[model samples]
Target chain A: MIVAERKPFDEIKESIQDYKKVLVVGCGTCVAVCLTGGEKEVGVLSAELKLSQKAESAPAVFGEATVQRQCDFEFLDEIKDIVGEYDALLSMACGAGIQFLAERYPEIPVFPAVDTTFIGVNKDVGWYEERCRACGSCALAMTGGICPVTMCAKSLFNGPCGGTNQGSCEINKDQPCAWYMIHERLSKQGRLDNIMKICPPNDWRNQTPQTLIQPGYEERIESSK
Target chain B: MKSGSQLEKILTAGHFAFTGELGPPRGTNIEAIKKKAAPLKGMVDAVNITDNQTAVVRMSSMAASLFAIAEGLEPNYQMVCRDRNRLAMQGDILGAYAHGIRNMLCLSGDHQQFGDHPQSKGVFDIDSTQLINMVKNMRDEGTFLNGQEIDEPPKMFIGAAANPFAEPFEWRIFRLAKKIQAGADFVQTQCVFNMERMREWIKRANDMGLSEKAYILPGVTPMKSLGMARYMKAKVPGMDVPDYVIDRLKGVDKKDQADEGIKMACEQIAEFKEMKGVAGVHLMAIEWEHKVPEIAERAGMLPRPQV
Candidate 1:
């Protein structure tokens, strides 16, 4: 899932300071699961903004709205009637959803309230760890399901780069060396020979901004073209 | 002779080759390279010019190799995978060979997080193993990594780094074999402070018959002070500074610790000279380049063999 964290209160407050009315919009998907930009978070941010405005004697009004998913135009259409009532929108969603909301409401200035971190999984209630980099090519099969591109500090293909110390990465002792883990897992599976096979340099030309057509839908898009 | 480098010739002739290291100055100071090369010229077979080692910015290793050549010292040009992609690396290799650099060391350099510029991006387009294979293909097959034929490919005596002290110790020898299979003519290992582990690692390499395929030069760095010893033991990654060595330094006076460190390094080199499957000793005197001659002579590696 796309994990995000709320931006600092000061930066969020400053971005909406100029607007007299600001609507705090939240998403109910990934951000909600991570506890960063859910309906409850939006309510808390709205209350805090109102209190901060009152203390500063600023004539700013805080409003709140939550959508099922901000990335979809259908879900976004539900907020269309009330969106024009505010001078600015403070979106608490991932980067994609924030951009979608901005595109949908082109007139109102949209400010991001959260920083989209990475494609990751929730380890615990407030803890998230990055698992993938979307590098366009995946070699997890050869690596015993551990992603070296995302786990190793250097994104090494032929690795354990002399920097694997005590099963930890050279950069930090707390982080497990991705290659070490791969070695252990592969050794257990009797696939140790996989590591010895030299992997050629990755073809990174597909790493640019990519547009994907799902398997069945590819023919549909091609026929339309 | 693959590249006709002096180091390669010495090793190929079954002579115990000795190499020294020269870290280029942070600025554009050709005089520093010349100064460092002076003491090592007659004492060692070749000199390794470091490429922004530890991620600190320095004069380009290729450029420094030219200066080392100007000083009449054969340079083992070091190329790290941290800063360049395949195109730049191949271009630099061709340029270095054109400028008289015959030896090259392929390395996955220290992480940028430990360097002067921690905010910089690392470009590990190819790991050191792939780099070794790439250079080998360019030299032996006369083809680029993309399989394009080169009018004139760089014929370099390729070298790679090994760390016996790194984690998953059982895999270290296998890694060395992989490097040998990747067409490494020679290999310089990580700094060795724990002689016991190094001996076992070397014995394992010999058992696998890997030593016959490539020359193994174990690196030795003399710790200048007790603080340096402690820092290396506790801080440096993939380094194993045995407790006995630290205790030995502690047994000495504060002012005499430098000499004690040199004594330990000389002792290691002496053992490496007699050990089976040991090809040479790579003396990395670090910032204390002036002391390399003294260390080499004391270790009985003086009067370097001429091929």
Candidate 2:
């Protein structure tokens, strides 16, 4: 899942300082599931902004709303009628949701209230660990199901560097070495021989930022005929 | 002979090679490079110029290597993936080679957190292993990373840094072998303070026949004081400073500790000369460059081979 964190209150204040009336829109999907930009967070942030404005005598009136998913136009259409009531919008979702909100409401100024971190898993309550780098080409099968691109400090394809110590990375003693875990798991599965094969340099041309379009979706009418 | 680097020539000629490190100053002081290269003129084969070592900003290693070349010293120019993308790295290789730099050391540099700019982002587009392979491709195949033919590719003698003392001690030799397979012409290990551990690791390298793949040069840094020893033991990651060595330093007088450190380094160098499949010793006397001549002479590395 895409993980994000709420921006600091001071930075958020600066981002929306010019607007007197602002609507804080939260996403109910990825950010909501991660407990970052859910309905509850929108309420909490709206209240905090109100309190800060009251104490500082800042001419800012805060409002709150939550959508199922801000990226989809259908979910955003629900708020189009009421969006004109406010001067600007403070999006409490990931970067994509924030941009989508702006694109849907081109007149109102949109500010991001959260920083999108990475695609990772929630290890425990209030803790998360990154597992993928989205390098486009996945090598999990070759690496015994572990993503060295995100786990290893150097993202080396040919196993660990000389800094792997006692299963910990040389960069930090607290972090576990990605290759050590890969080696152990592969050894358990009697596939240590797989690591001996040298992986060629990563082909990064396929990883550039671009849109993915489903081929058949474009020719649906022709296909039906 | 492959790259015509002095260090490579010395190692290939069956003579024990002696290499030293030259850290460029933090500012644009070109004189510092010349001053550091003076005492190391005839006492060493090639000088390994560091690239923003330990994350601190300094003169570019490529520029410093060029300066060292002007000072009549063969430079083993160092490049780290932390600072540049593959395009910049490939371009720098050609630039360094154009300026008479034939030796190169590829490193996965220290994290930016340890350097002056902790907030700076690191660009590890390619790891050290990939960097080695890339350089090998440029040198042997005469092609850029995109498979475009070059008019005259850089003929670089590739080198890499090794840390035998880091975690999972058994995996160190395997990592070294991987580096060799990745196209490293030589291996320079981290500073060695524990003889038994280094010997055991070297024995494993020999058992695996890794010496035939690349020249192995063990790194040695002379401790200036007891405090330095303790710091390496506790603070430095991937450093193996045994308890006995620290205790030995503690046993000595404060003023004589420097001498004791030199003695210990000389002993390691002597043993490295005798160790089977060992190429030579990489003396790293940080901030104490003037004492290298004395240390090398005492270690019987004086009068460097004229390859």
Which structure among the candidates has the greatest lDDT?
A: 1
lDDT for each residue of candidate 1 in B146-222, tens digit (9 for 90 to 100): 99998898999999999988879998888888888999999999999988899899999999999989999999999
lDDT of each: 0.92, 0.89
Candidate 2 TM-score for chain A: 0.94
Q: Each candidate: fraction of true contacts kept?
A: 0.74, 0.39
* Candidate 1 collision pairs: none
- Report the C-alpha lDDT of model 2 over B1-307, residue by residue, as the tens digit: 7798888889999999999999999999987778899998998999999999998999999999988988998999999988998899999999999888999999988878778998998887888888898999999999988889988999999998888887667666777887899899999999999899999999999999998789999999999999999998888877889999999999999999999999999988888989998998898999888999998888899799897
Total clashing pairs for each candidate: 0, 4
lDDT, residue A165, candidate 1: 85
lDDT, candidate 2, A162-186, per-residue tens: 6576788877889899998988888
